[model samples]
Target: MSWFRALKDTTRSGLTVERKRLEPLIALRGTAGLAVVIAISLSLFGPAVAAGSAFGGFQAAIATFQRSWRPRPELALASGASLGVSTFLGYLTGSHLFLFLPLLGLWTFLAGLSWAAGPTIGIIASSNVAMMLVTITLPTTVAEAAGHAAMMVFGGLVQAALVILFPVRRWGAHRDALADALAAEADYARRLRHDPVAEFDPAPLMLARSAAALTPRQARTRPAQLHGTRGVAERIRPVLASLADPAVGVPAEGPERDRARELLAAAGSILDAAARAIRHGTPVTIPPGAIAAFRTPDNGTILSGPAQRAADRLGPLLRDVVETAGGTLPEEAAALPPAAALRRRLTRPRRPRAGPAARPPDLAPLTAAAPAAPPYRDPGRPLRRPTLFELVPAAVRAIRREARPGSPVLRHATRVCAVAVAGYLIGGALPLGHGYWAPMSAVMVMRPDFSQTYSRAVARFGGTLVGVALATGVVQLAHPGTELSAALAVLCAGLMYLLMRTGQLASQACVAAYVVFLLGMGGETWSQTVPERLVLTLAGGLLATLSYALYPAWETPRLRTRLADWLGALGEYAAVVVDHYAHPAGKAGPEVRAALLKARDAHIAWQDAIDRAGTEPVRHRGLSNAAADDAAHALHHLGRVAMLMEAHLPERDATPVPAAAALADALRTATRDGARALRERRVPRWGPVRAALEAWDGEGVPDRVVRRGAGMLLEALEALSDALDTDVPPMTVKPAHETDGPREP
Candidate 1:
């Protein structure tokens, strides 16, 4: 009884898992079924009708493949080649049409090659028309001619069906990907607000790119698909504008008012960042004093001095809304203090004497025997930016650019054509008929990814060899007669269906084997053809390799310029972040969100550029690497700061102080110090002094809380400076609690 119960439970669990896995497939089944129905309908029609439909279908499929296969051109070409080979072999042996086999093989190979190279539907249709004419003259029997024609038509129809079904299912996937990306960004922002140990990271940026790449058909929409959920500009525009309008007074309700006020504050910060990005491309540099003030814990009232000054600068309507709402703002709302003031207090102004200029040590030396790293992993350092070669289509594009117009592709095509011509010439000279293996091998070897090409070549060779052996055995079992031949033909159709469903490579082998067997049953022996095909195949591969090596191709250049451009953009983005923090509540948030999106787009572009750079030849490597790494680090830090500012804005604004002059002086000083440090190539130290000033400026927070938060921020800044070897300065300001009531400008 116990065992039986356990068995029942296991069965139930298995059923649950199966149902879960099958759900998505079931949802997509309708479209898949539609494609299958079209293929089956075409097959049911008589050979003549099927032939007409096949021509049109093949043309459409080739055109679509060209447009969609930009990133994976080799795969498209291979698929076409596989189709042509299967069709030719099917007709040669299945219908006992030995005399027409060589002609059919050549025609199919040329047609497939042209389609793969240029993808013109019209050209393919024309090729089919020629094939139809040849079929009438070359086939000794009507049935044989009809069977070959039908194979061509069916092959074309299948290609068309697959293309139509793929895109429709991708749209929903993109939406889901976007939602996941936004949620991840929000989570990262929240973590920055709560965790002091955490530093900025570009994982979020990477996630965003991945999300963007997903096709829409695959995306699933959730409630968070609304722009507001992602902190996008569209979400904050209304709230920011409302805050500047006096008519919409702060709500009298409790939680409702709180939510409204919080939204308004967030919007203000976003707008401020956007405005700053427009004014200057670099990130807004935060004074150490401002960081200290926000870190203070005693309700942040001690920081109100600079906050009030910022409020005074706002238009009347916005000031009224804040006052009436009884809402506080973030400490960063006070314009950042100067870097010079912070630097003067923290360290001497003189530059460090140059020896080695504090060079960072290289962790790994170059070695021939060292294992190469995977594309996703950094070649050396943990946080290094990816090189261009790691990316796919970019590498191919870069190579293409090196050659003159249409050189690399055209050169390859020409070599393939030459191999076929040579094969025909050799056949004529020897009186053994044109060899199909030479041209077929050329198709197998043409690939952008070396690994894929290698695998396919092996598979093709193995499958063909096995197929010929199997044909010998089958012919020995069944004599050459019409009834046996017809039975074998039916068996080939079943094999085609199975192979198509299994995989292209596997199917190709199966088809080849069936063809060999059919030929033997028709009185031709595999022992007579096997050795000849192998030799021809070797000839084709050699020609293909020669063409690829000799073709004019572009070498990948150093990607430093692209990386530098991205770094410059990131600097600008950081400046915008500072502006967002400095702006008065209700004035900065909307615009800041817009700026964030721009930054996100810029990062995506940088990734693409890097991918392109990596694929280039060994020359000009590691050019933009340093700049890209620095930019990534900066963005991670800025994102964290933005989250913190958003979380504390309301509490900080409630403080009242009169330290505007001191804060501004401190900010100016810090900015100057930072500029000087950058020039000197030294890390600046200003966090301690900034913390002291923040402790002194704020009046609302209990002295201990203000002191502790300020201390933490100061320590954090010091760590950052040490990590990046760059200096930052402190800002000065008076405590907000010491301020008199609202002051005149």
Candidate 2:
């Protein structure tokens, strides 16, 4: 990509407004917290103290809005306390530039390292550094600084108190995450009705899994409805796929296909109903038609073999979903396998017995209290995330791992630290009244990636211009007193919260206006601050952009490594799935689950690298665009084949296919060698995999699904080999896989 194209794309990205639903109530609540802190501080110590303290409430409110599983009040408190400490330390050295510059560099570096923890921590830590620069200029003496710092902490305390006193939709984020996952599955079910082999992105399920992780306190207080449903959702995806596949399950043109369509439609409706119930904490109303379809006896007859089995599995799972949604689920119900769970209560017996007919029980809300059993854990435990405090040592280890040459985090840290110091020196030398604005802008806008850093810089500068103009006009027209300015500042803060989800441009615009009004309350004139702020902000943005251009950590160079990682993970996943066919009694459920998770993570990493690489002004040296696209296409099919095989895994006591053992070994060996060859920039030859597939070429295999998928897998690998060869013309390339066609009965 050329520099001009990169710049144009990033600018468009910066200007793009995401069409997300606005949370007015939550934003209003956050604004109210800011209002209380400002009102109280203004009453006690007048406008200047209020101005300094508002930063605490303001930043803390932002922190609470981060996408973290931790409690919102806890986030608010931690953000507040951290900002206070940063401000106090910054004030200590504010008198001497010699002392402050060193402190600034060290603080900036540490903030950069905080990314190892997670984006939430990294964002909060970066804000801490930015606040240090802005707040240190407010206090004149050490005693005064202590008082100001205490007031800031008090601001955070006020927000936390407000959260406890008037909670809004408690456990709301968790509910939303769980609901989104179910909704995605519902959509997938609908799509599969037409395109049985349609692809489903697992991102939503992954998010729900992350949301399920809880602190001990959260676990104790969790709502019963939120428990166990996630596991049921996980089990449903495979069943849905298996039932829809033409080769293994239903026929393409027959009455059985119509029955399959009816089941899928009913499943979609049930899933949709479940999602709504889970989201709003309401009673689940299972559609009468959906229940009737499941109860239809011909469902068992028309859908025979794998299709029948999948239909059987899906009915019980959906029942659990409805029961769980109505809060009527037995706490110990999760311990039962999906095929056995809720069978007597929700599902009618498949055959009539020599007994009286009983009506199927309605999923009524049950209030009986039993000791909650430890929840059914996922095989790989991929959903488990460390608590914030627990992440400290892990974060330290990550930082240490990145403390080497060519580590992107290390390069980013060094780049940011250098740019901040330089921006500060330049801003001070130019006689800017608020020199801190320069470095603060630099710190806030400079991210580890080219796209974000550039987009944010563009957005920040544009937002500042609009904001400063609007704010200065207000001050000039109204000639408002300190109290009015403070009120205006509160209003602007509210607007920022409301628009935060829209885009960086909208939120940053409000932030600019809020800051202008905030500083106005502290007796800084619009004339003195407005022009200086605009100029300094531009300088900071320029410094950040220029620094990246000079010392870039291009994702293009790491593309091969990321691709190799994904190939290896996908190979392991395929091997585990195939191994299940070879040794049915081994029950490699945990291993398969773990391998799938690792493969998913690697896939995400590779895609992210590609996106980052696309926006970088660098040549694709080793891997051309055409090659990368072809390779990714091939790998995607390989993964889908593994997934399809996993859906048809044999039961524990089922007969093992001895031929699968050789294929599994070949997959492991070939992919390991392939990854090594990829890293070394050589065209990998999958001789072993090809040989293994040839051995099964003409055999009358009992396990048709495994054999067919292995053929598809080998085809994908061969295509991958051609992609990496570089000798093949991009225009002559052919895809290994095709959209699956419906089969006749």
Candidate 3:
């Protein structure tokens, strides 16, 4: 996913446990400024000249203020200054297209470029639009502009003060990230129980893992305390994945088989409880009976070796979940009888390779292992800080990419610019009152991809209609005084920000009301604006939607290419990680870690590409639904295998793993052939990778962990190969075990 997706206006799924639980807390960001407007109306301030101060606070709070000193003041000050300057320029440009067109072009270029920098730029984008549109119809002299500028800065300062005055815990979001992943894992377990051949959605778990991977780099969390969160998830993925495959997991159809399912379901429940605890940053609570009932190897009905093995492998994972919840041991576990003699009698010593094997990560300390997983980073070169200087260069780059013929971003930019210019010219030439609205809507609604553009345009159209209608009713019902109007506007602004991440319709509606009240206090009457607002908004929406339909970024033509991109990245990531496994010099070194991180980034892009491709008009979609499903499932399965391998690397090389290297090369070749196959309308032979995996020397590797990991690589390769031939559909793929197929580890 791109930075823009992460900055989603509303929180996706509303699953974040850290999100404010109370209504007032949700509205605080908006009210911080309303309080200022009230003071100004009460004559607590000298004049209405500084009214932009309220908006300044409103903008800064939207930046997600925290107790940290680094970004809050910086964002607040920058936004206030930008708002002041842009507002002034826009007002001046209102009288001249010579100034407006070029500046608008420059701002749009900046908006396009800022997308790579992350969600902050999105907030800045809204600010840019507001700066232009808010005062176009109002009289703005140099003196008024200066006063408004200062006032907005004052509002930003007020927001900063409030942030400092009211502090919240910093780990809330981080905790939720880990919790979300665990919960998703639990869900996966439940799915495995219900349908042995089922494959659960990996998006949520992937997103959560990615977010949790960043905890170390962010503020407030103790790095050591939580380092193992992702690592824990990494180890657990294969376990859950194994369960989803009945051939390698479930026992025979009998009471023993029933017992295995019950235990797995219980394990899922415990993990869910653990996720809840982590989400709330509290101790996990569950009945002691839940833990007690998890005891395995029961019923005296001998299960098939695979079923028995699956049950045995599942026990430690359940215990790990309990440990992660920061709860006391179960009553039975609290005072366990010593098993030293029994262990000596039953355990077989793992054979040494040439030298002593490095100690594998202990499962006893589950949280401690979480940090061991490689941290996520950009797969490509990291973006430089966005600046005004880069605007021209970025534009040049955009032109060049699009010049190659049909770049999505370039196409989108052209669409936006064209529609914007048309709206501007049409609005100004005709006496459409405050004609900027048409162009504003046009620019706001058009997106890089069709789905977002279409969806947003619809939302904007429906939202504006309702929002403006409500504002009109309220204004007519109560011709309130300036103070009351200002207060209402402030309140509406707060609600808008609160709903931004929760509901787009609500946010849009609140914003419409805010605009109405804001203008009312600024000496504009609702009666004169309603009809104009409706017409302008409708025109903007229509222009945006039809413009895109005419100049479409058709999905079918690009599906193969997008799929190719994902396959290529997947192969590269898998190859690198396997090579590292074969010849690991240091545990989790920068090179291997970087490769793994790069894979994560590629996976995000691939996922987005596939999703966007799916949304394209099916009539023109070149790919088959079954093929699309296979591609996604294979890619996701490979990604998890890579992640699991990345987390379980040994500290030092015992012997160079030739098998892993061979497997890596085979994958690269397959990937290359696969891409070519797509281009040539043919399927690639995937036998080399499967052969390489099968050729692995598990016996030559002394470390059980390393050997098991190697075996898993082959098993996954076989599964993916089966998928390519349509021999094993997602709903019926063979189960992967920790060892050779059908063989006990």
Put the candidates in lDDT order, highest first: 2, 3, 1
Candidate 2 lDDT, tens digit per residue, 1-745?
Answer: 8999999999988877798889888899899999999999889988878888999999999988888887788788888888988899999998899999999999999887676556777788899899879898888888877878888888778788877887877788999999999999999999989998787777788778878887667776777667778987987888788788786778887988898898899889889988998888777766777766775356656777778777876776777677566644434444444433443434332221111222323422111111111122322222344555765677787677666677677678888899889988998899767888899999999888899999999999989998999998999999878999999999999999999999988889899999999998999889989888999999999999998999987788788888888899999999999988988843337899899988887887787788899889999856999999999989987887888788778877788888888999999999988887777677788999988878866555886777878888898899998999975323232212111111000
Off by over 4 Å in 3: 1-23, 41-51, 63-78, 91-94, 136-139, 168-170, 213-218, 221-227, 243-263, 293-324, 327-406, 498-502, 573-600, 634-660, 690-745
Which segments of candidate 1 are over 4 A away from where they belong? 1-436, 449-529, 552-745
What lDDT does model 3 reach? 0.57
lDDT of each: 0.36, 0.80, 0.57
lDDT of 3 by residue, 575-659 (tens): 7777876787755466665565555555556557666665655342335667767766776766666654554454584566666
Per-candidate clashes come to 94, 0, 13
Q: Ten consecutive residues with minimal summed lDDT in candidate 1?
A: 736-745
As for TM-score, the candidate ahead, 1 or 2, is 2
Shift in Å, residue 542, candidate 2: 0.6
Model 3: ten consecutive residues of lowest lDDT: 736-745
Give the alpha carbon lDDT tens digit for every residue of 1-745 in model 1: 1334433432332222111112233223322332332345334643233333333333233333222212222222333344444344434553444544455445534443343223332243223423342224233554644554444454444444454444432223323333343343334323323332245334344443333332222222211121121223222222232222222222244433343334334324323322232122222222233222212222123213322222222222222122111222234333323342243235322222211222211101111101111011111111222122333343344333422333323343444445445543454355444254555555544443222233344555555666656655676676545335434533543454333334334444555665454343344456655666666655655555454445423222313333333333433443343333334343335555555555555555455545533433234332234534564455444333333333223222543323322332443345335434433334445643474367455643332222333333334344435454423222232111110101000
Per-prediction TM-score to the true structure, in the order listed: 0.39, 0.89, 0.74
Error of 1 at 684 (Å): 20
Model with the higher lDDT, candidate 1 or 3: 3
